[model samples]
Target: MSTAVTAGASGAPRRVPATVHRRRWAILGVLIFALLVVVLDNSILNVAMKTIASPAPIGLGASQSDLEWAINSYTLVFAGLLFTSGLLGDRLGRKKVLLAGMVVFGGGSLLSAVAGSPGQLITFRAVMGLGGALVMPATLAIIMNVFERDEQPKAIGVWAGAVGLAIAIGPITGGLLLQHFWWGSVFLVNLPIVLVALVGMVLLIPDSRDPNPGRLDPVGVLLSVIGLVLLIYGIIKGGQLADFTDPAAWGTVAGGLAVLAAFVLYERRAEHPALDVTWFRNPRFSASVAVIGLVFFALMGVTFFGAFYLQSVRGYSALKAGALLLPLAVAQMAFAPRARLVVDRYGVRATCAGGMALVALAFLGYLTLDTTTPIWVLEVIGFVMGTGMAHVMPPVTVTIMSALPREKAGSGSAINNTFRQVGGSLGVAVLGAMLSAAYRNGMSDHLSAVPPALRGPAGESIEATLGVARQLGPRGAALVDPAKESFVHAMHIVAGTSAGVILLGAVVALVLFPGRLPVPDAVGAQPEAEPEAAPAETA
Candidate 1:
């Protein structure tokens, strides 16, 4: 039987083909499995950093900068290529692209597992990211393709829940693997999962693509990739050097932004634009993007530091720290379903803003953290932040997708995720930089009385400081408490700053997002022709 979409009268709902309706849930499972592996890879490394950087068999002796790159390199490459990857999937076959991505990602994981140096690991991570760019957008785009409008919210809810589940499980999985096996086991573990997903995807999912896929935009691709990489490079460099005024830092940032501006202008004029520049004109879409970006900015920034705080300062083992983070996952899972209901009853503006406010309050709560603070208090704070994040992400993602025509879902999903990846990258870059600078200054003052020979390495990082203290025997005991204290002080500053930024995002959501989303036109409705002189809205 040939499946078909039945067109509706004006304002009426379109009928989904019977073929699609029957297989939708099965397709969703494959998509979620793929998404889980990609999202899980993003955080699993956090728990294993200690092992990777430790001095021994797998010793890389990675500096703070090297560690940050090990994490951000994947994100930076993922963000830069998302739009282009989406375009290719739309023009080529989505399933083919997805299968190919899985292969590449699996290969990257294999290489990463055997990596001997920080640089090799970082490079392989970027390779995984290239594959991720294909997988991420294709998952959502496939969901949009296979499901009807009425089913979309629920399906998207499931998709969003899978992401939260990945975040929750990633650390625990890494911690367990690190406890019994080597740090390389984290990357190695992806192989079996990828194999299962690949088999399922090939057997269950059908290929789909844009019927009228347009010309490839080479210049636009070049500008976006270059601009984003340079911008992120500058941010990471600034943090490492701890100098905002360095020409290499600020200058590259300025140049990157300028190139991006040119790309936007060119996109408006191009007949077959890689990204529809006018999507920002819709306030609901733009505000939702901003809110998601800011939420991740805070989430990633805190997660990066929090892992270190638990292990390095509080002296929790990797397994314990990962176990402690389970409360966050539990809270998020508890709240995710309710968040959808809240959006239905209260509207996105209220739900999103309220969620942001909760996250800000959580951050404020962390301001009191110290070496002596109870473990239960940290759990409470994680729960509060996780619940708030649960509220924010789902509705915001749905809103962004709802604003676009179903045919444009791949590109739209890519754009939405691109901002998210960019925000997370920046979060780690900016917050990591701040923590590094503050720790250096605080430790410099605290360790001034120590022997000059010990000052330099001790000031390099919290791990280095503790390592130095361990070497000095009884004399090193004096440096241990002060180093931990300095680290806590830096953490306090990061939490406070993150709170303010999240609050600002909440205000933006409240002010910019409409009280309710405008009623969307029929699914697959042709977008109106772009106006020649439409003013670009700032994102």
Candidate 2:
């Protein structure tokens, strides 16, 4: 087979005819497979949290907060480092970066599989996040280097579809794995897939980098990382706020803001800055990025809350909850390809705004949900929301990537992901806290017999009590059902708030997005701007 390949990190290979290189799609296949593992890891772990936390060598009694960190920690670091990861790729070389990421990720998964405590798992998860930061942006940046711009939207659509497939199947796969083995088996699953990807990388993928890479900005990198962590910490703590006077929680809030503000100031001055703050000057760039963030924020909120509601309140097991989310994934998969076409003909403004409107409508539909709501009704809402979200993500991604020069794609992808992660973190924390508060408040009357002092703490920790009730048999379980009902009612309030936020996002998109996608000189072509200047020095 004819092949085009780079032998090492810095060397160029002998030129091969186009005919020979056509067979090299095997490399792309491997990349896709590896991507599947990482994406699947994100969703699968969430589904298996309770199972993993069960009695085991890990000794982790998985709480909802543990579940949140298992998912969010990886995403937080991944999002935080995305901008810098891309720049790193440009300077370091794609294949080398990709391999390093794989090694770190695989090692992290191994650590996670054997973790003996919740704290250990959290630490390892951060390690995985660091690796993921490298892998994701490199994968996309490599694709951009290989494919023509005209081919980009379709390729990325298929790429996103693969990620969607992972989302669709992860819970099911996780359910099956948990059924057959311990929770650690979920992390164990990565080793074989990653091994195959690593082998394929040496054989099929080539090394590449930007022709003119700038200096690295360590200060900018630290600022971005600390800033994101602080912001998310503050937002998550917002739910625990008792009249904004609680210094412990509110201090997290204030410190996080200070860090983020400092990050912005550093970015503006840093030479070879991690984030290109100039992009926000363009209305299109800022609006598209915000739209991307809001859509995913709402999406993650639904997934995070819905998973808990399905099992804890709706009485569905892990397998059934995964099955229920399948339709939403199907809707997303089906609509994603068509989204590009819609963007092509209608323009980004109309497609994004219209999609947001549909999401709002879906949220409005969620307002009717109660404890007895039919499965089919929920499925319909999933279908609508999925389609709307599918339409939003790819177009915004294409618009943002296409707007930037080639060298900036990695950083651009990182920025896009950062906003997405931030929004998602906020969504889960805010929506979840609301649900927790409402559930607690509503359950106060139901817990009257539990002793007035215990009642408050009991409401705050219904699941722990429910676990105890399950061991005590029918009478105990019966007593707890009323509290469960209260929690469900609280969830309804959360759904109402999420719907409102989504509606606001739709309106904002409609107002800000252009009537159509911009027709550039060429697809994926960089915008005309002043000469490339070195990053300014930071204090």
Candidate 3:
């Protein structure tokens, strides 16, 4: 019956209607469904790429770079716009923005289904990314607002689990769709899910926004978007070229970093800042972010190449490849709920470190995989990796969300998701570059005896190499066997590198995260030097 006063982003108090608390759990279900759709869109395209690029009735004639762009463009735009979108939601009602995002995302998917060219598909995917940016942060911010501090970790666990669940299901769903219909089926599948989320969100979710919402920062938005686009562009180009020495590659990367640095400087001094950079000053926040980024870095990189290894090198159908990944999904879903309990008992630092250790162990196992490695071996390793990911994500996400004041939840959620998207993009770029370079070099040495014209395509990609092999008939064995060997060697190199990065993250988590979650009263408590500001007057 009474309104509860809560601190706003400006440290001013604002009244939250008591009725808002009653609908929290039902609201969480809607947020999770919304989250599932956005997260699934990120990976569902992976298994559908080959079909989309195939020649004839559904031919897109997409080159390797085009295929990579189809994926990277979405992530790049999503990462770039997240901070701004979150701030917009805080200013303009999260529920309003979330519903709008669903419309945009659904529209993009529909456009993508009928796209006649690779360029059109890439453009539509970017549109979807814009919608995803709007959707992702609001889900987390709404969860923070609805759930009380004590209930947050469990709620966040379910939210985090939805992400893992989407990752697990996206490929299989795409595989099944591709089997029954065309490649466009993958994008089209989002419609029914989005429609359901829209209706549920409209009915169950309450609208919330900053009571003291400040002036918009257009400069900050511009700089962040341009910088992220350039940065991601350079990374993707570097991977494609396998040569960072190119002036264009290094120049873009340097310029992007400089612009981002400028954006940070501008934010700190801006009267109405879009992001609170001071959050990173907290060791727990910084460490949790680092752990999240590193985990995704390794996981995304492995998934990017691993899918190809299964489908291309091992000669598995897309459907079968998707089925094989089931072990990973199962392990992740099974472990995520229990991870919070582990954090409650052992502490955030221990749980995260243990998770990273398991991930490193899984990567170590992957190093042994080759053309002859059995499917069972991969399934077992995938299970191990998934379990590790499950452990790392839920606790780390809870830690980050827990560290922030309720008013800053939108920006905080955006920052966390931004790091994750950035990490995944970089992971695919860096690890893919490593794989590309190694594969090219290995193929070159073996193919030196072949005609120069035929050798070029063979060296460019595994798919091209296989095509060359097929055309050569009986003579193809010479090129085929060596190409497979080269791919295996390249995969091993990337796997080993990923193991090292995750091990470093484990060390960082151990060093930085506190032994336990902060006490409820201490969580996001304001500084003693700054007394509580007066509540913002209701209109």
Best by lDDT: 3
Where does model 1 exceed 4 Å of error? 1-12, 60-66, 521-539
The TM-scores of all predictions, comma-separated, are 0.92, 0.87, 0.92
Higher-scoring candidate on TM-score, 1 or 2: 1
- The predicted structure with the larger lDDT, 1 or 3, is 3
lDDT of each residue in 293-357, candidate 1, tens digit only? 88788878888789888989999887788788887788777787567788778988898899999
| TM-score order of candidates, top first | 3, 1, 2
Using TM-score as the measure, the top candidate is 3
- List candidate 2 stretches off by more than 4 Å: 1-28, 57-73, 237-245, 452-454, 468-481, 522-524, 527-539
lDDT of 3 at 524: 39
Give the per-residue lDDT of model 2 (tens digit) for 55-120: 655437866667667766786677667667777777777778889999999999999998888778
How far off is residue 309 in model 1, in Å? Answer: 1.6
Q: How many Å off is the CA of 426 in candidate 2?
A: 0.6
Q: What total of clashing residue pairs does each candidate reach?
A: 0, 8, 0
Find the number of clashing residue pairs for candidate 1.
Answer: 0
Off by over 4 Å in 3: 1-18, 522-539
